[model samples]
Target: MNETGIPDDPLLLGIDTGGTYTDAVLFCERSGVVAKAKALTTRHDLAEGIAGAVDAVLAKASAPARRIGLVSMSTTLATNALVEGQGGRVALVMIGFSETDLTQAGLRNALRSDPVLFLPGGHDVHGNETPLEMERLEAEIAALAQDVTAFAVCAYFAVRNPAHEIAVRDFIRARTDLPVTMSHELSAQLGGPRRALTTLLNARLIALIDRLVLASDRFLETRGIRAPLMVVRGDGALVSAEFARRRPIETILSGPAASLVGARYLTGLDRAIVSDIGGTTTDIAVLENGQPRIDPQGASVGGHRTMVEALAMRTFGLGGDSEVTIEEGGLSGRIVLGPRRLVPLSLAAHLHGGRIVEALQKQETRPVPSRLNGRFACLSGMPARHATGLSKSEAALYARLGPEPVALDALILSSAQLAPLDRLVARGLVSLIGFTPSDAAHVLGRQTGWDAEAARLGAALFARRRDGAGQQLATDAEAFCERVMARLARRSAEAVLETALCEDGLDGAALAGHELMRRALDGEQSVTRLRVSLDRPVIGLGASAPLHYAGLGALLRGDCVLPEDADVANAIGAVVGRVGVRSEAHIGQPQEGVYRVQVAEELRDFPDEEEALAFAESVLMRDLHDRARQAGADQAELHVTRDIRAVDVDGSRRFLEARVVAQASGRPRMTLNHD
Candidate 1:
C-alpha cells in the first residue's frame, strides 16, 4: 500500500521436477493459483526444462518476472537417485566399528563393494574416548582420495560426542578437495551403523542436489526473476537453497511430501489417505489432524533406512512408466508392473521419429513374436565414465550400441547376452524401452502425447504373446491394452490396501493377499459376505491421478477426491509451506552435580545441571533463530521443548539426561521491487 492504499503484486513461482515431467505454477497471497504449466524433464540439461516451464507459466499469467517475489522448487532427484542406485561414488570411514556392525542396518549391502576404512578410535556411551590414531588415517588418505568423489566419517557413539568424527572430517578436508559428511551432522541418534549409512547416502547425494540447485538458480537468474530461492524438505517444510545443498538427505521424499501438503490444501481435508503416483514410484501416506503422519523410525527409501525425519509414506515401484512384464510359471499368464521404470515404446517412437516404428513393423513381419518383440535398449544420459565396471561380455555388447534406440531382438546376438544388458540397465548406464502402462494408455486412446500407431503395434506384439498353455492373451490390441490398464488398477488398489492394513497393525502383505480380504476388496458374492473399506477418504494426486485412480473409490469403498489443479499439486505445495529450522542439545550428568552438555561440536562441564541446561538452551535457541532467518524466514517465531529423563529415587527425582529442542518457523520473506 504505497500512497493510495493499493497493494503491490507479490507473486510466487513454484516448480516441481519429477522423473517424467516438470511442472510450474504462479500463485499469489491475495488470490490462489494464477496459472500453471508443464514441460518434459531433460536429464542431460535440467535447466532447459526449468526454463521452459517457468517461461510458459509466466506467459500464461501475463505477469512480469520482476513481480515474482519468491521462487521455490521441489524435486524427486534425490529420491530417484536412491531408487535407481545412482550417485557419486564415496568412501565410508568407520572409527571403532567392527566387521559385524556392517551387518546391522544393511550397512554392508548399502556399501555394495564401496571402499570402507576401519580405524581404532571412537568414544563410549559416556562420550569418553581413546586418542584417535591420526597416523592410520594419514597413511590411507592420499590413496583413497583419488578413487572416491566424497568421504563419509562416522565414529562409534559420535552422537554423544562427535569429537572423533569431527577430527577425521578435518583430517580428510585438509588432505583432499572432496566433500566430507559427518554422521553427527545428519542425525543425533545413538545407532552408529545407521548413522554411518545415512552419512554415506548424504555424501553420495551432495553433487546431485548441488547440480539441481545450481540449475534452478541459473535459470531464475537468466529469466531475470530475482526472487529468493527455496527448497522443500522431506517433511513438507521449506528451507533455503543453501541449507538444502548441505543436507540433501533431508530431501529424499521432498516431492511426495509436497504432494501431501498440496493434497490437504487443495481438498481442505483434515484426515485422508494421500496417494501420489509419479513415473517411477507410487507414494502413499496418511494425513491426520490436517498434518501428515511422521515416521518415528525415520524415512526408508529404496530399502535403505536413513535418519531423516519424513512422512510415513509407503512407496511402491508402480507407476505410469513402470516396465510391464509377464508373471512366469503360470498357465494363465498375468501382468506385473515394476520396480524399474522404462521408456514407453510409443514415447521412444515419438522421440526417434520413424526409426522406432520401422523396427517395430519389421519385427511384426515375423511369423511369431520373438522374446524381445516390443523391447528396445538405448544409452541413458549418464557420462562415459559411468561405464567403468562392465565385464568383457558387457563391454563388447555395449560398444556396439549407439545413442539411438536399438530393438532388443536385433541387438542381442545370443541368449547369454541378455544378462549383461540387464546389468547395464540396472547400473543406469542404459535404459530398456518396452511396453508400459503409458503405452497402454496411448493404445486405448486414454493418452495422446506420443505416437499412437507405434503404441498399437507394440500392443499387438504383446497380445501375440503366449501363456504357459499356449493361448492368445487377448483378442486384439485394444483388448490387450485394456488388460494392461486393469492390471495397473488392481495392483494400485492392493498397494493402497496394503498400506492401510499396515497402519491397522496387521501384516500388510499377508492381509492384502488373504482370501477373505480379496473377496472383500472385489465385492465377491457368496454365502459368506465380507466388506472391507477405508475409514478415511482417499485423496488422489498426480498428473495421471484422474486417469489411473478413477476406480479407486470402488476398491477402497471411500470417496476418492481429485481436486482441481491436481497435476500441479507438488508445485503448489512447494510455495505454500513455511520455513522451519530445528536444533537440539543433549545435557547429561557425568557425576554428582557435575553436568556435561554437548554443544554444537564440543562438550563442556558445568558445576550444576541448571547452568548446563540454561547454557545449552541459550546456544541452541540462538543457533536455531539465526538458521531460520538465514533460511529465508522473516520475523520467525521460536519454540523450545525439553525432554528431561529422570527416575524417582526414594523421595527425589534423579536426573539422567535431558534433550533440549528449539524450532524456529516463519513464512518466507518476499522480495519487494524498488522502482
Candidate 2:
C-alpha cells in the first residue's frame, strides 16, 4: 500500500453532502488536501452520489480506501428538509399542554398535518410532580405507532424534570420500534412549546438522517473501507454517527459551520467575513478572533426557530442552481434569482440528453412564447413509500411522471394543475428543470461540466420571452446569459453587505436597497457621493466560489479571498474538526434550606446551596466526558463553567439557582492499523 512512496501517516476521507453536489476530499495530516472531487448529488439514492465522489477522489489520489483512518461528513440535508418542508411524518405527544399552547412558538404550524396527542402528565417549574395518567396514551399509542415513522415526547417543564417525558418515551419504545425524541434531551430552556417544536422536528428528521448514515456505511463496507465514521454537527464539531442520528436537529447548519471552519483553516485569518456559496443557497457569517460567533438566540432555518446551537450564519436562497424567473412589469424586465432551487437546464440535459435537446428544439418553432418553454418535469427517484399521502390530483400527476424528462407543457393539462406540481416538488417527490445561473454560465462559456448545447437551447427559449412592452428580452442566448451573470454577481454582493449591516445592529433588509447601499455598491461618483465598504475581507468558499466570487472584491470595495481549495472546504473541514459535547445540570432551592439538583436522570435533594452546586458540577463533568468519548473522542480535554443567580432580599443577596455547564473536546479517534 505504501509502494507509491507517500507518507505513512493515515489519510482522512472527508465528504460534504450538499443540495446539488456531493464533494469528497482526501486529506493528510502532514500535508494538506491531497485530492478532491465532486459528483452530482443523486436525490433518488444519495448513496450512489457518495460512492461516485468517493471513488473519483480515491482514484485521483491513487489511495486505497482501506488505508483511510477516518471518514467524516458534513451535510445540508437537515437544513434543506426544514427549508423545503419535507421530512418523515411523525406524531407529537404533548404532555401537560393545553390545546391553546399549540399556538405558541409556531408549534402548530411545525406539526403541519401530523397527529398530536395531548396528555395530562408533566412536571411543574419547581420540579413538582403532577398526577401521572397513561389511560389516554395506552388507548392511542398502538394506533398512532402504526401511522407515523417516529414519535416526539415533550412534557411541560421537561427541562426542569424529564421524568414525565422519560415515562412516555419508555412506554412508546416498549410498544413500537419507532424512534422517540424527548424535549429535555434537546434544550434546557424554559420555553416548553419551543422545546416541543424542536423535539418534533428532530423526530421528523430521524429517518432522513438515518438513511444518510446507513447509505454511507453500506457504501463504505462494500468498498472495504474500515475507518471510524463521524458527522459534523451544527456547531462545527464532529460527533459519532450514532450521536448524530439521535440529535439530527443539531445538524441544521452543519454544512455552513463546516465551511466556516474550513475558511479559517485555509486562510489562517483571525477576523473576516466568510461566504460559502453552494448550489442552492449562499451562507454568510462573520469570523472574529479566529472563530465564528454562535447564534445566542438559537438557529432559525426556513423561518422556524430551533434550539440548535450553530454559527450565526445568514443563509440566502441565491446560488448557481437557484431558479431563474422574470419580473415582467419592471421597465428593465428584472431577472429574479431564486428562493427555490431547480435542476439546472444544463444538468438536466446531461441527465436526459436527447429528450431535453429535442424538447427545446421543438419549443423554438412555436409562434408565441410559452410559459413552460424551458421547463421540464420528472420524478425525483424517491422511494415509492415517499409518494404516500398525496392528494388525488397530485397522485395522478405523479403517476404520469417517469424517468425521462417531460416538457412541463406536455405534462400538465391545465393551469390549475400547477399547484399540485408545486406540492409534489415540495414533498421531494418530483423535480423541476429550468434556467439557472449554472445554465447561464454554460451559455456564456464560463462553465462546461454539463451539456453546453442543452444550456444554449434552454437559454435561447428564455431569450424569446416577451417583457412588459411585449418585446423580445434578448437577441440570443449569449446576450441573455450575460444579464443572468450580472444579476448573480449583484445579488451576491448585496447578500454579503446585508449580512454585514445586520450584524452591525441595523435593519439590513431595508438598508440593502437603500440609496447609500446602492451608491456604495455601484461606486457612484456624484455630488453628495456616498461610500461604504466592508471592514473585513471576504473569504469565499464552495465549489463555485472561485467562478462566481472573482468580481466580489471590486463590488464591495474590500478584499475577497478565495482559497485554492475553496471548492472542497466543507469536506476538508469535516475531517479536520474535533468532537465536542456539552452537558448541563441545574441546582435550585425548593425551600429556604432545602435544595434540589437536577442531573441527567436523577433529582436529589441537598441541605445547602454549596452541596447542591458541587453535586451538579460533578454530574455535568461526568456526563459530558462520557458523551464526548461516545462521540469518538480520545483522551478528550474537558472544561466547566458555573452560572449562579442570586436575588437581593432586604439588601442581602439570597441564592436563587445555579447552572453548571461542562464541555469536552478532542480529535476523533483513529484506527491504529490503516490496513
Candidate 3:
C-alpha cells in the first residue's frame, strides 16, 4: 500500500498522441498523477514516440512495466487527418442513390478524385426493398479493388433495413482483403448521404488507425504490460481498441474529448469552458454538471458534418505550430495564423542541428526578401503506396525531395512549381517547415529547448518583408515575434468567445466579429465601456497554455484556470474514462394494430404495440450489455430510455413512432495480475 492507503501494485497508464507530441502519464486512483512525460511525435514511426514517452514516464516513477493494470490511449491523428484533408484513397459504393445524391452532404467534394460506384438497391421507410443489381457490382468489383485501399457501402433507408448494405459489405469482404465500412453499422440516423459520408471517412481512416492500434498493442506486449487496451471515443467514452479500429471516424475529436474529461476530474468543476491547445488545433467545448455536452446533431470536423455522436467541440486551426502568414493585398501587412500546421523552424533546427540553422542564416543574408524566404520542405515519411495518384508534375517534384529538409528557393525555380509542392504537402507525402508561433515563442524567450538562433534568423527574414505600402513589417525580430504572440492570444480569446456564443444558440461566427463584440473584447473605453466575458471560468489545458493564455482572462472578463498537470490532461483522461456502448431500436405503426420494430439489421412485425416495445427494449438491453463487455467493460449496468411520439384523436391516444434506447456503462476492465 502507498501512503494514500491505496494499493500501489496496480497502476494505470494513459497515452495521448497529438500532432506534435506524444504524452504518457502514470496514475493511481487515490494519488492522481504519479509521473508524466512527453516526446516529439514521430509520425513516420509512431511506435518510436510511444516508446519514448512511455519509457520516460516509467523511469520517472521507478515502476515496473508489469505494474500497469490498464492501458488506454486517445489520439489526434484521425482528427488531424480529416482536418488537413489527408487519408488513404478509398472507393465509395452507393447502393441506392443516384449521381445527383452525390451532390448532397458535400459527398462529391469529399470524394475528390476517388471512385464511386452506384447500384440500384435500397429499402423504403416501411422496410421494403428494391431489387439489387448484383451483376453491375460483380463486374466492376475487381477493377475497383485494384487501386482502392478500402470500400464504403451505403444503402438507401439502411437504418430501417440493412439487408442491402450487408449484402454489399459481405460481397466486398469476400472478394478483397481490404476493409469495408457500411453506413448502417455506424449510425441509426435516416439521412442517407450524410451516413454515406461518415462511412467513406471511416473507410479512409481504417488503415491509418489500424496501424496505430497495432503498433501500440505490439509495444505493450513487448513491455510486458498485460492489460486490456482501451481507446477514447469522441464522446469522452472508452471502447476497446478493436471497436475503434472499425469506426475511426468516431475518434475525430478523441483528444479534445479526453481533455474535457480530465479537466472536470482535476478541477472538480461542475460547469466550465474547456479549451485545449495542441500542436495543430485548438479545441473548445463546454462542460455542464461535470459532463461534456454531447452534440445533438452530430460531430462536425473539417466542414463535414457526420452522424457520429460526440462532444460539441469547435476545432480551430490555431495552435503553437500554426503557420504564420502575411495577409495579401493589405497595407497593414496583417499576420494570419493557420488553418494549417507547419514544422516550426526552431524545431526543425533542433532535430537536424547545424544544417537547419546554417540555411536560415543564409536566407537572412539575401538582400532581396522573397515570399519563399525561411521556407523548407521535406518528405513526410508516408509509405510510397500513398503517392499512387499524384499528378506528373507532383511526381517529378516529389522525386527531387528526400527525407532531409531543403529550402524552397533551391527546390522551385518558378511560381508554376509552387502549386505542385502544395499538392504534395496536402497529400501528406510532404511537410512544410517554416516560421510558426513556436518559432515566435522561441524568439521571445517564452519557449526554450529548441534552436532559438534559427528562430531569430527566420524572424529577421520575415520582419524584413515589405508591406503593401513598401514599409518593413516590424522594427526588429523581437518586436515582430511579440506581435505574433499577441495575435495568438487574441485569436485564442476569439475562439473561446465564439464557442460560448454558439453554445448560447447565437451565430458565433457573425456575432464574434461584430463591432460591438470587437469593442467589448478589446476593452474599449469611451462614453460607454463595452465588456465581454464568459459566464463560467475557462479551464485552459495544454503544454503551451501557460505561456499563451496568461492574459486571456482579462480579454474574456473571466477567470482562467490552468489546472496542475494540464500538460498531460488528455493522457490522464484516457485512463480514468469509463467504457460505454449504446444500442437503439425503433417501433412504428404501418396500420391500425400492426407494429413494426427495427433493431440493427433485424426487422420484425408484431400485432400489439406493447409487445413490440417490450421486444425492442429486451433486444437492445441484451445487445448493449454484450457490446459493453466487448468494448472492454466489466460488470456493466444497463439503462433504457423511451421516446414515444403520438397524437390525440377523439380523446384517444394514437401511437406514431416509438424509439427505445439502451445504454450500458462500466469501468474498464483491468488486469489484476500480470505474469
- Candidate 2 residue pairs in backbone clash: none
lDDT of 1 by residue, 1-675 (tens): 433222466889999988888999998777788899999887766778888899999888777788889998898889878977878889999998989999999899889878998888898777789677767678888988888989999999888889999889888888889999999888888899899999999999999999989978888887888889999999999998988888899998999999998898899999998989888788999998999988999999978998999999888899999998888888887888897899988889999999889988998899988878989998887788878878999998789787899999889989999999999888878878988899999988898889999889998988888999999888888998999898888888888999998998889988898889889988999999999889899998898889899999998788999999999999999999989888888888877887888867878889878898899888988888888988889789999898989999999989999999888999998895555
Off by over 4 Å in 1: 1-8, 96-100, 112-121, 139-147, 171-176, 673-675
lDDT of 3 by residue, 1-675 (tens): 744444665799999998899999999887788899999999878889999999999888888787789999998878878877878899898987999999999999999999999999998887889998878889988998999999999999998889998898889989999899999889999999999999999999999899999999999999888888899999999999999999899888899989998999889999999999988989999999899999999998888989999998888889999999999999999999998899999999998888888887888888999899899999999888778778999999999999899999999989999999998988889999999999999999889999999999999998999899999999999999998999999999999999999999999988987899989999878998888888899999999999999999989989999999999999999998899889899888878888999996689999988999999998888788878988999899899999999999999999999999899889999885644
Candidate 3 structure, TM-score to reference = 0.94
Whole-model lDDT values for every prediction: 0.88, 0.90, 0.91
Q: Which candidate would rank higher by lDDT, 1 or 2?
A: 2
* Model 1 superposed RMSD (Cα): 2.7
lDDT of 2 at 471: 79
Per-candidate TM-scores read 0.94, 0.95, 0.94
Clashing pairs in 3: none
